[model samples]
Target chain A: MTFRAERRGTFRAERRGTFRAERRGAFRAEVRDQIAKWRRDGVFEPRSDSWLTGYDEDFSRRLGARGWIGLTWRGRGFADRFVLTEELLRAGAPVAAHWIADRQIGPAIARLGSAALKQALLPGIEAGDVRFCLGMSEPDAGSDLASVRTRAVRTDGGWLLDGQKVWSSHAHRATHAYVLARTSTGEHKHRGLTEFVLDMSAPGVTARQIPDMRGPGHFCEVFFDGAFVPDSAVLGSVGDGWGQVTGQLAFERGGPERVLSTYPLLALTLAAAGPADAGRVGELVARLTALRRLGKQVAARMDAGEAPIGAAATLKMLGNRFEVDVIEVARSVPGVPRAAIDDAVLAAPGFSLRGGTTEVLGVVIAREAMGAVG
Target chain B: MSMPDVEEAAVKVLGGAADMRDAARITAEQGWHLLGVPEPEGAGGTLADLTGVVRAVSAAGLSSPLPELHAPVVLSVRGQLIAPWGPAWENVNLAGEPYDIGDAPSSGAVLTRWRILHAARLVGGCQGAAARTAAYAATRVQFGRPIARFQAVSALVAEAHAQAVLAAAGLEAALADPEDDLVAVAALATASRAGTAVARVAHQVHGAIGVTQEMGLERLTRRLWAWRDLPGEAELEPLLGLLGEERAWDLGAGDE
Candidate 1:
């Protein structure tokens, strides 16, 4: 064997249990099923028209028979969906809608929704027939999200929401968008914001999808032009938005989906190559082996309902860096080309900046881990 | 895991006393009876299997570390040491700190929990080597001469090599016979010293790469520090003291 071949041949001689693909749940199984179907059948690829538009009405309703959405809350079946989320992201499924609802909407309602409020709207969301978007960051309020100036005037009829939300992923597609509005001034920046599930179809709400350089059109600018909301629309208590959003953010930040986004493409890259790329494979194995374990640790924590807030943030940051590293490493292999052919690398370059940027996540880790922000 | 499995296996092997701690010292130095390392009995396994079930429990999200360590002691009172059985064994622990578990970690229940901390010490058994290499590798020159040389690089590898040696010595010593000697204590000290330093030096060598997200060295290093802080640190001196006391006791018994 040549020098390069020798290195490649001995790459994995010392390691064991290298692969990290998970198949632990029915939900995950269904996701695996969908992923297989999508790849083999050449299923729906995202386009301009299909991006914000809801799925076929009957198709969506049919999809809800098994209750794949919101599977792990109380009174619900123990079908956990985080693994489902992980699988979907790994498959590169257009899970933007599901990500929004599962990440933000479901938790907001379950925690703060009034009994009547919960009874009326939750089943549709639970069934995936309806979707919700988060309205957290404003144009000026990127990392300082609490600096949002959205106002909800308490009039005789109900709340009159007049605010603008930026970077609202899936705000245009959702049936309802859970929004954060400032009800009253408080000493703390995070004190006054209140979380509300706004009916996007209601009068005066405008959502337009905006294109971004990294991966255009997953984000939007949502404007509530005196959007009328009944008192029932308030999720959690008024002025309890800060606490509610914090809890929601913790749930959002900590999930297996954050780590396994580009996994399928990685599998594809490996499958296409032969034995010449052995040493690279060895390094990848060691990395993903430890990473999978760390992801499992965080997942176990989330599954147990103990939001490892600090630890989760640490994982999120770690995962983004790891993902970026994998991309760099994969691109350098002798067999692989400099640029992706089917647009894999360029398609999701901004994933690191999504959900929460690595820098913002650093502050979170600092506050919760180091106990500095008192 | 090794602690408990070896402790129980120690009782089963030299079945004289329930407190394998007394008998374990002789087993530690005279030969390699401990799991993994080759010995006269010729039985061996990894840390995972020896302490398998208990460690499995901890790995599967249970809080207990190694129940086997305490199990032998728990059963010790039942066997009277004066009337010997197969082989008389003595054990003297050389950990550097007490369990400090708020309540005494003296009972079988507590000792098992304390061992988890001990097991964590093995997590990044040689992280210091990685760090030691990264520090210079990032800045060091090659043929012109700074000495990172490659991705793994040598200085850190040597540093980790030393750390692994310490860990090996510690593991070996923990299984020694109850002969009441310094070799066993030295083994524990050697392992602790090496294990702790390996993690530090590995980070030092690796520089920013050692702790960065892409860095594979952080968890090992973190686990080393975490394991080092375990209650075992307090136990070392006491174990050494016990060795001195046991030798006196043995001499007294011999006179009788």
Candidate 2:
């Protein structure tokens, strides 16, 4: 298989009165080569079973040297690497370990961190030495995100933090967690919450891992008991965390990671179906192609530093349907014993719920697509 | 390449941002995506299951499809193939077969449903055709290696894909559109023919294995044969027989 030179402007913005598909000059080629090298070196390896995971520190060092961990901006880890992340996730590479810093923390820090904070944190990200976990969702506040009751009130030289966070992915072994805390007591709701960088090893912060259905523990529930973050640790402004959180969410749901989970299975299925399945495979290819087209459109918008939220939701919904269908197709192939269904079965049920639930996407289409004119 | 087993499946529990009032709210809040199901638990369901659910919502009358299903889900997301035809269509007659829902539906309208059903039958037919072809080529021997290695036998298998593609698309459209049209029925007839053609050719290639239980061609072909008759061929039988009898036609003409 040959990797094409990274191409940009592959998808034109509909907003541009006449958007034609075009290649993104030398910059795209350079990116394409970099991605190829990353792929060859297994920079986007499939988390646990990856060939690199075997050697531990050596792999981490290699990753650090290549800037796979902190892809953009010399001192700002996640600044430029957002595209790499979208690519890796879409490619179905295991990014479980650094999932947090790359998606949530890095961006938050780059935008809000002081000169002092940058030096203490960024190197660990470059070297993959600092694994971070997210602490956003709470038992009471699931998708009603503003309901986060985890509180961090002002204190001398620091802030006293206390609250609980559930569904925090990869917390047990992480070096730290970027948590959302309630700073205001009133019902300003979204306006009341704040963001914090919590030291996982601190005496008061406790993280207990939650075992996943078929795999190792990927998520956890963390409880903060009088955990203290000095004034330097608050993420963004105390009252402005809502904007920060939304920005983080945009990063969270806007990528290919949500659709390529079963990529290996797809590859295997295609290989097995062979010449007889050429037609069926062609139909599948069309769906995949459409998905890529849409995805690229959204990515291009982001590259230009625009929010394509509507398109992102649409992509997420599309990705959910296609992802679930891909798994179901694998399940339907005859002769493989039921035991072989594996994660395909376990993951399919939640396909609609993940990312933002397909239902909400329909709402987006309705309000934005249909209601926009009205 | 070898075929993956049909029945094996793992569960993937998924949820999506939910706000039935608007589908996107639900989809976004629920974390709906196809890959890496953002859901906390469970395995996957078929496209038919999920799509069927949406169609059911429309049929239930709890919501008007115009603003909901047709507006956002179909026309907006799936494009205009699903646009509403307005109030003109209510029934239709084709090739002397008069199928009606007691209302005056234009042939274009009624045929749309048939088109969808016909497509489903065709999909089943395509799969059956491919399986039968494979079974035949796998067993028949010539020049020391199985005849499957020969280009002639292989060509039959390739042909099934062409037939299967038509069937699959027809079925997909029928399912996607969800209407009662003759196009769906025609699609079924086409599928049956395509599937039978593939199976018969495969049997000729296998020369015995095609009939064996172990080989499974019989199993595949049987499904194709049965699906060809879906949506009440029996319903059509009386209507067709009555139309064929000249007395009613002549009587109606004389009265007119």
Candidate 3:
């Protein structure tokens, strides 16, 4: 009887595997068809780093209506999300409006947000009405995020936030901002930090767009002068924001976005690649293939409830390099549009800077490597 | 045995061998070369099983004919194929490893197989180099702290480790579908490129000691240099050009 039961279990597992694979295939096909149609209809122009630069609420709403946003929160797997995002980034879709919310914050809130917070924000997030901008990096806390001086003080039924967040992308248009502020003094720098979701239009909140080389960019400096956030808006727990924010880094850094930020330029490069340029283009594709596989492995690990922090850092490190290298390869190939190359070149610097700087990623990866050896 | 157990066994057996000749003999006696051979004639393990033994041997920094033991003869101008008992011109590569020069028939499939195995070796070499470099960086002290504390040295170690990870990923993809020539070529190209970067960074972090034979970092770095250019990125990269844009984007489609 036990042997028969085990055999039946194995059969069920096999069937589940097959079903998952089929679902993934169908979903990927659907995404490809939709992207092709969008291109044909002039829905959005393909651009490098569209995840950051492209802000089309309508496009995001369409994706949300198709149930592509908040995939993991909706009982879909990371592999499914991986397929969706890979195709979206490959086509350089206008995903920025919903990117931060959908990519990390939505999942975070689902996992750790208060009941009221979930009821208030998750539906809007899934429907593409709620957009989120990060408030982790402050003027003095670029790489050392633990040094953020943003303070959140206790109040009657909420907290009063007083600080400034720099390089908060899309804050000007985001409906919400996820900010990390210190609530109390603790033994270490990583302590006393708390993450809170603040309404963008709160009375004391102000967002000022910072013009960059790209001109009228999404970069913003957000100031909170006694902005009020209810206790329900707190993500995770007080004094544990360090752990929570670090946990989100794997999701932020490991995705296909890190690798495919410059894929539009690569597509253009491939169209213009001559026989002589084949070697160069082929090299880029080979690296991309490897990086994508690594990404898939990371996603699979995440699905299995593993953080895979080191693996994620390694992916971003190599992926950031690949993202920048695509520009040079594009430049070398004749007939690749000059405007595309210029856009990629201007966007290339931030590929390694955002999420985590290359230097910071190197530290993380090397420390992991050292730990393994020891 | 499981794949990791097979690799562990290979490492244990190969570790007992004194030199390349002894290692080759042990490999044959253990039937590792016939791991993927057909039943009755030899053990019928999967390609993945053979990969375990290949990775073990290469990671041990031992130069043997294990990877090519069952492979069909392919051209070797610098003479990497070892056949000591056969009548051939014995030569040494950049790593000072001996190989034999002889005319032999070659097949495209066999070449791809050889490339896959060699790419695995390169992947192993990169891992070995990266591990050793990282270990050294964490222990070797300067300016009252380990050099790894220095961001520059940390960057070097990270580069080596990252390259190893990338190369290993490529090898995994190729192993998944070894029969696919495009996949094999891409894997080899990625591994070959990684080998150069890993070797360079390993040497840089080890400073002058990395070059000396006594220090033993040369064992992996030299092999990396020698194996890297053998049908390296330059040779394998062009094959990827055969793929059109759509196919290139969608290569290894069903497997994913």
Which candidate comes out best when scored by TM-score? 3
Tens digits of lDDT, candidate 3, A1-374? 11111222112122124235466778899999999998999999999899999899999999989888999889887888999999999998989999999989999999999999999999999999999999999996678999979999999999999999999999999999999999997569999999999999999999999999968799999999999999999999998999999998899999999999999999988888889999999998888889988998898899999998999999999998899999998999889999999988998889999999988999999999999899
User: Where does model 2 sit among the CAPRI classes?
Assistant: incorrect
Q: For residue A321, give model 3's deviation from the true position in Å.
A: 0.9
DockQ of each: 0.02, 0.02, 0.33
lDDT of 2 by residue, A1-374 (tens): 10011211221221233222232223334544765686798665432111111224444455566667655345422223533554444334555666657555776676788666677787787788887777888897656777878898888987888889987766777888988888888777878777888889998889887767755555589999999887788877877888877665556665655555554455444444434344343334334433444455555566567766656665666566666665665565453334435645665655566456555554443233322222
- Write the residue-wise lDDT of candidate 1 on A47-97 in tens digits: 211212223334334335546566655443222454555555554555555
Ranking by lDDT: 3, 1, 2
Best by DockQ: 3
Every prediction: chain A TM-score: 0.81, 0.80, 0.94
What are the lDDT scores of the predictions, listed in order? 0.50, 0.49, 0.85
TM-score versus the correct structure, for each prediction: 0.58, 0.52, 0.93
- Candidates' RMSD to native: 18.5, 23.4, 4.4
Name the top lDDT candidate: 3
Candidate 2's DockQ: 0.02
Tell me which of candidates 2 and 3 scores higher on lDDT. Answer: 3
10 residues in a row with least lDDT, candidate 2 chain B: B1-10
The TM-score obtained by model 2 is 0.52
Model 2 residue B210 lDDT score: 65
Between prediction 1 and prediction 3, the one with superior TM-score is: 3
Better of 1 and 3 by DockQ: 3
